[model samples]
Target: MTDEGDLIAGRYRLQTRVGQGGMGIVWRATDEQLGRVVAVKQMLLHPGSDEAVTEQAVQRATREARVAARLKHPHAITVYDVVRHGGKPCLVMEFLSSRSLAAVLAEQGWLPASNVALIARQISGALAAAHEHGIVHRDVKPGNILISRDNTAKIVDFGISRATGEATVTDAGAIVGTPAFLAPEVARGGDANFASDVFSLGATLFAALEGHSPFGEVDAAIVLLARVARGQIAPPKTTGPVTDVVLAMLRNDPAARPSMRQVHEACTAIVEGRTPELPALGRPTLVLPARRPRKRVVVAGSAGVCLLATGVVIGMSLAADPTTIPEVVSPPTSATAATTVASHGCTASYRVTDAWPGGYQAEVTVAGERGRRLVGWSVTWRLPEGHTIDDLWNGVLTRTGRHVKVSGADWNAVVPAAESVAFGFVGGVADGQPVEPKLTCRTP
Candidate 1:
C-alpha cells in the first residue's frame, strides 16, 4: 500500500491521493529536485493479477505517456515526466488548481448553453491540436476536463490517447474509454480516430447541456454500449445556440462529422454569438437558434448606464436626482448617428446591469431606425485600461488591448425595421468606476 509522504522513484514525494479510477490512482506530489508540485498517476494493477497482463499495461502507459508529452497546448495539461516505481509506470503531470468538469456537472446538474460553449471552445482547441499531431484522445469525458478558478479550461489525462500509426497496446478487440461518451464506431469495436474523438466530444457536451448522456443513462454497461453503438442520440431539448454544432459533431457517420479544427472554430463562433456553418453537413439546412431563457432585470435609477434584459430595464444605479443623467460617452443617437454611421447602419445603447467588487455586468442593444432595416451588425467600443471582459453571450467578443468588437449572431443578425438585437457581457475592472464606451455600429 502507498502511504502519504512516500517517495516515488526517490524524487517525487507523495502528499495525498487526489483521484482514483479504474485506470490508476493520482496523487498530489512534490518534485523535491525541481521544488515544484506535480500530479503523479500510479497505474493500478489488481492484487495477484497475471504478470504478463501487468507488464503489458505498464508498457502501454509508458508509450502513451510519451505520446502525451509530445502534445503542447495551453488548453491541454502538461506532461512533465514519466518514471517507474515499484515496477509500475508513474506519470508526472502538471498539478492544476482546478476541479474536473464532471465534478462541476455532478454538483450543478447543468450549465447555461453560453457557459457550455465557452468550455467547448477551449477543450476543442486542445483536442484539435492533438488531432493535428495525429494524436487521438481515446477518452474525452467530462472527468478529463479541468476548469481553473479563473475559468480557464484544460483537457487532462491523455493516458488512453494514442498517436496515429502506433501499434495496438491493449489486448486485441479490447475496448477502452467510458461507454456513455464513446463514438458509435468505437462502441461497435471499431478503431478510434480523430472523428471518434469529435463524436466523444459531442457526447460530453451533450451530457453537460442536457444533464445526461446522449444515449440516456442505463444501469447495465452492455445496454448502454449497445445504445451508443446504435447512435441513438436523444434530441437536445436545452442546448439553445449550441444545438447545431453539437448535433453536427454527433452525426452517425464518422466521415460526415466535422474535423476537430472545425468544431473548435464553430464553438469559437458560438462564444462570440455568431451562427456556425457546418459544411460537413453536406446539404443546405437552416440552422436556427434554440429558445433561451430570459434573465431578470433590476432597475436602480433613471440615469447613467442602465442594463436591460428582454427589453426591460435591468441594472441601473439610482442617482441623487432621478432626472440627472451622468456625463459619459454614449453610443451615437439616431440624429448625428447618420453621418458618423452607415447608410443603413444601427445604433447601440449601453447600461450597467449589475456590479460587485472587482466585476460588473453590462448589456448593449443595437437598433435600426423605424423605417430602416439593418441586416448584420457589428458594434465596436473600447474598454478602460486594466478593465477586461470575463464572459459575453448573444454576440461574439473580440478584444485587442482596449479595443473591442461584438458581432451579432445568425439569429440576431437580421433585425427587422424598428426592432433591436442585444448582447450582454460580464467584465472585470481594477478599482475604478465603469464607464460606458462610445460605440460605433455598422451593418453589412
Candidate 2:
C-alpha cells in the first residue's frame, strides 16, 4: 500500500496527504527528476472491488487525465502526467497552495458579492474555454473550486467530465454529479450538456453566497435527488447583485438558460462594476412554493438582540446613549425620492464607499426617530436598472426583483430611540455613476 514518504514511479516521492475523496487520494509530492513540487492523485481500488469495478476505476483515472490535459486555461487545473504506480493509476498535476471553495465556506460562512463575482467570472471563463473544446465539466461544485490565498479561483477534479461525442462511461441508468448542484434535466436522467454545466456553476455560486446549497441539506441521497428533479429551490436570501444571473442560470428549462459565453460576459460585467445585461427569465415550468417566513430566535442579553431569518443578528450598544445618534440628511427631493421616505420612526441613508469599473461597495445606516424603541427594523430600497447586490455584511439581506431589503441581525435588533445600526454590501452597477438607491425603513 502507498504510504507517506513512499516513492511512486521512481521519480515522485509523496510528502503528505493533501486531499482524499471516494475515487482517489491526493498527495503533495516531489518530482525528483525535476526537483519541483507536484500534486499526485492516486486512484483508489478498494480491496473488495470486483474486476468490473476495478477496471472502471482505472478507466476513470485515465479518462480524467485525458479530459483535463486537452484543455489549457488559467482557471483550469493542469495535468502533468498519468502513470501506473503500485498496480494502480495515478495523475501528476500542478500543486497549488489553495483551499477548496467548500473549505473556505466552512471557515468564512458566505462570501461577499464582489468576491463571488470575481470567482464566477474566472470559472465561467474556464468553462467557456472547456465548452469550446467540446468538453463538459459534468461536476461543478464548491468542493471542486480551489481558491488561492490571493483569491484566484481554479476549477479542478474533472473525474466525471466527458467530451461531447465521447461514449458513455457510466453504467446503464446510473447518474453522475453531486445531487445538490445537479441540473434538473440531469437529475431526471437526461444527458449532461453544456447547459447542465452552466446550471451547476450557478448552484455553486448559490452555495458561495447562501452558505448552503439551494436544495438545502439532506441526509438521504434519493431525497435530495428528488428535490433537484422537482426544482424546488428556495429563493436565495443573501445574493445581492448577482441574484438575477444566478436565478437565470438555474432555469428549470435548459433552453432558457444562458450559454457559457453569456455567463462569462455577465460575470465579467459584475466584476467590472457594470450591471450585466441578462436574458429575461420567463416563468419556469416548475413552480416553487411561496417562501416560508423566516423564524426569529431571541437571545437574551444586556441589549436585547433578535436573530432574524437570515441568521444575522441586529445588535444594540447598551452603553451608548440613544440621543447621541447622528441624523443623516435625506437625499434632495426628486422623482426617486418620491418613493423613498423615513417611516415608522426610522430613516435610512445610502452611500457608495468604493467603486471600480464593474463593481462597487456601499453602506447603509438606519436611524430610529427620537424616543422610539423598535424591537426590530428592516430597510428597503430600489436598485437602479442594471444594478445588483452580490454580498453584504452586518445584516440579513434579500432581494425580490429590484427591491432590496436588509433586516437587523439578532444582536442588533433593538433600536433604542435615536440610535442607529448599519450594514454594508458590494455589488455591480452598469454604466454612468452608481445610482443612489431610494430608501425606506420600517419596524416590526
Candidate 3:
C-alpha cells in the first residue's frame, strides 16, 4: 500500500522504490524534518498472511535496526532509527548513491585483481569492526555489498546477522544464507561464527573476480548447496597475486581461515604490492555431520540471503568430590541470594552453591548484554579474612592475600552476546558470619 509521495511518521516522504529483498523493500525517501535524503526499508508481508508471520517480519525489521546500530564504520551502512507506519516497523538508514556490487558484476562480468582487492579491503575493515563488537554477518554476498559510482563500497543488509549468545529469532531447525556463498561448515549443517563470516567474504570476492560462483553455478539451490558442502573451490585465474589470499579464505576448514582482521591486513598488503603476512592455518573447530536429507528448507531469490531458527542451551554439571568444589545444594537463606553487578556492558552475578562445616562453594556468572560480546573476562573480589581458596573450575584462579582473581579458560573464554559463562570455586570460610564478597568484572 506504500507508494511515492506517501508520508511516514510525518517525517520521511517516500519518493522511489529502490530495492526489494526476501525480508523487505527499500525506498529512497526524503527526511522533511531534517531536509536530507535517507533510505527506508519496510518489512514485506504477503497479502492475507497470518498474524504470526507479520509479527515475525516486524521483529526482523526492528532487529535489523538494533544490530546495525551497534556497528560504526565508514564502509558500513548506518541505521538512523526505526519508525512505524501502517502497523509495521520501518528502518531508517543512511542513503547511499550506489548500486549493488552484484549489479556491477552482472554488467561488467568481473573486476581486476587490484580493484577487487580495494573493495575487499574496505569490506573487510567494516566486517572487522562488526566482529570486534561480537556480531556475525552471516550473509556477505555481493548483493549485500553496495558499490558507488566512485567505487566506495559499503556493506549492508544485516537483517539476518546475529550477535554472539543472542537468541535465534526465527523458527527451530532453519538454516539461512545464500547457498552459493555459505561456508562449507554451514552448508554441512554447522553453526556460523566469526570464521564463517571470513569464508563468506572470501566467496564474495571470489565471485567478483571469477564472474561465477567459486563452487560453480547450478540450476537448483540444493545442487549448489551440495557442491558447497563438498568444499571444493575452483581456482582463480583472473586474480594474480590476490589468488593466495582468496584461496586461503576458501579453505574447507573454518578455523584454518585467517580472521577478518588478518584478511584486511592481507588485502591492504596486496594493494600495496607487499608480501602479505598471514598466519598458518589451524585445525577446524567444527565437525561436519554425516550426509543426510533435511526435512525443512527455505530458499530465496537469485540473490537470496539466509536465516536460522535454532537455539543453544548452555548447562553445567559437577560430581561430588571431597577434594574439589562440589555442586551447590541447600545454603543458608542469607547466603542464597545472588549479588548482581554490571561492568563494561556485562553483568556478573555471584551466588553460593554449597556450604560445609568450614568450606563453601560459590559461582559467578558473567553475561554479555544484547548485541555485546566479551572476548575474555576477569572477575575480582576480596575473600573473607582468614579464608583460603581451595579449588575452581571453568576459569583460572589466583589469590593475593584476601583478594581473588578468576579469568576465563580456553574452553569458556568468550561470553557470547546475550550469552553467559560461569566459574565456580570452593574456599575455606571464616569462623563467624557468612559474608558474601562483592564481585567486580572486567572484559577485553
Candidate 4:
C-alpha cells in the first residue's frame, strides 16, 4: 500500500487521500517541479491475480490514460500526465474540488428540470468532444460527472473509455460499465459505440431528473442487466421541458437515438429558453423475431415518435405560459434614484426563467446603490453544493470550487447606483432548488 506523503515520479508528492473506487485510490497531490496541485490515481490490482491478467490490466490502463489525455475541452477533465509507480500505472490529472453527480443525487433525490438540462448539456458537450476524436466513453454516468463549487460540470473518469477501431479489452461476451446506465446492446454484450455512449448519457440524465434509473430500482445485478437488455424505459415525471429529448435518447434501438451533437443542441436550446428543433429519429435496427415470448419488446416509434410530438406540445405550452416570460429590469438613466442595496452596496436577485430535469436557466440581476456610479464591478457568490453554471451572458464568469465570480463586460461595466446591471446564466442544480448565492460586489 502506498502511504501518505509518498512521492511518485520523484515529483508528485501525495498530500492526502481524496477518493477510492473499485479500480484504484485517488490522492490529492502536488507536483513539486511544476508547483501545482494535481490528482494522482493509482491502479489497483487484486492480490493473487494471474501475472498475465495483471499485465493486461496495466496495458488497458495505459491505453485509456493515453486516450483520455487526447481529449481537451472545458467540460472534460484535463489529463496532465501518466506515470508508473511500483509496477502500476498511475494517471496524473488536473485537481478539481468538486462532488460527483451521484453524490448530489444521493443528497437530493431529484434535481430541478433546468438543472438537469444544464448538466445534460455540459455532459453532452463533453461526449461530443470525445466522439469527435473517435473516443467512446463506455461508462457515462452520474458518478463520473464532477460538479465543481463554481457550478461547472466536468466529465471525469475516462479510465474505461476506448478509441473507436481499437481491439476489445474485455472478453467477447463480458459487458463493462454500470449496469443501470448501460445501453441495451451493451448490456447484451455488444461492442460499445458512440450510440451506446448516447444511451448511457440518456440514462444518466433520466436518473438525475426522476430520482431513479429509467429501468427502475432493481438491486440485483442480474435483474438489472435483464431489465436494461429489455430496454423499456419509463418516462421521467419531473423533466418539465426536456422530456422529449430524454425519451428520444432512451430509445431501445441505438440507431433510433439522437447524436450527442443533437442532444447538446436540444439541451442548449432548452437552457436558452427557446424551442428545440427535435432531430429526426433514425431507423431502428432490424431484429429477428423471437420464438419464445419475451417479457417486453420495445417498439421504436411508440416511445421516440410519441415523445417528440409531446415535446412539441410542451414547447407550445411553455411559450403560451405568461408566467414563464422573463422580466429584465433595465438600469435607471439617472444616478440620483433610490436603489435597494445588496451586500457591499450591491443588490442582487436570482430568478429561474425556465427549467427541466438535470438543468435550469436563470437570470441574476445585480444593482449598485443609488447615486453611486461605478466604473467597473465584480460580483462574487457561492453556488449551492452540487450546482454548476454551464453558460452565461452579459458578464465574464469564472469559478473556483463553489465560489463564482462574475465581472461586468465592457458594455455593462459602467453602472450608476440608480440603475442595476443584470447577467444571466444556465446552470445545473443537483441537490435542491437553485438558491440565490450569497453575493458580494466590488467596484473600482
How much does each candidate deviate from the true structure in C-alpha RMSD? 22.0, 21.1, 20.6, 19.5
Once superposed on the true structure, which residue ranges of model 4 sit more than 4 Å away at CA? Answer: 280-444
TM-score of model number 3:
0.64
lDDT of each: 0.69, 0.70, 0.70, 0.67
Query: Tens digit of lDDT per residue, candidate 2, span 337-444?
Result: 222357887877676655567666566767676646667889988888988776555465656778887887444566555546566666777875577777888887
Order the candidates by TM-score, highest first — what do you get?
Answer: 2, 3, 4, 1
Residue 89 C-alpha lDDT in model 1: 81
**What would the C-alpha RMSD of candidate 2 be, to one decimal place?**
21.1
lDDT of 4 by residue, 44-113 (tens): 6655558797787778777867888889999988888878898787888888887777656654656778
Considering lDDT, which of the candidate structures 1 and 3 is the better prediction for this target? 3
lDDT of 3 by residue, 259-357 (tens): 999999999998888988788663222233322221111111112111111111112222222123322256788777989878766678888765667
Tens-place lDDT digits, model 1, residues 1-444: 788989999999999877654346778899999999988888766445587977887887778679988999999988888888878888888888776676566545577888889999999999999999989988787767777888898888676677888875752556666667878777666678999999988888877787666776443344455566667777667746587788888887888899999999989998987887667574212222432332121111011010011111112222223123322333223211212232346787777655566776677777785547677789897888778875564464555667898876433556666656566666778986566677788787
Better by TM-score, candidate 4 or 3? 3
Better TM-score candidate (1, 3): 3
Predicted structure 1: lDDT: 0.69
- Identify the leading candidate in terms of TM-score: 2
Instruction: Say which prediction, candidate 2 or candidate 4, comes out ahead on lDDT.
Output: 2
Off by over 4 Å in 3: 282-444
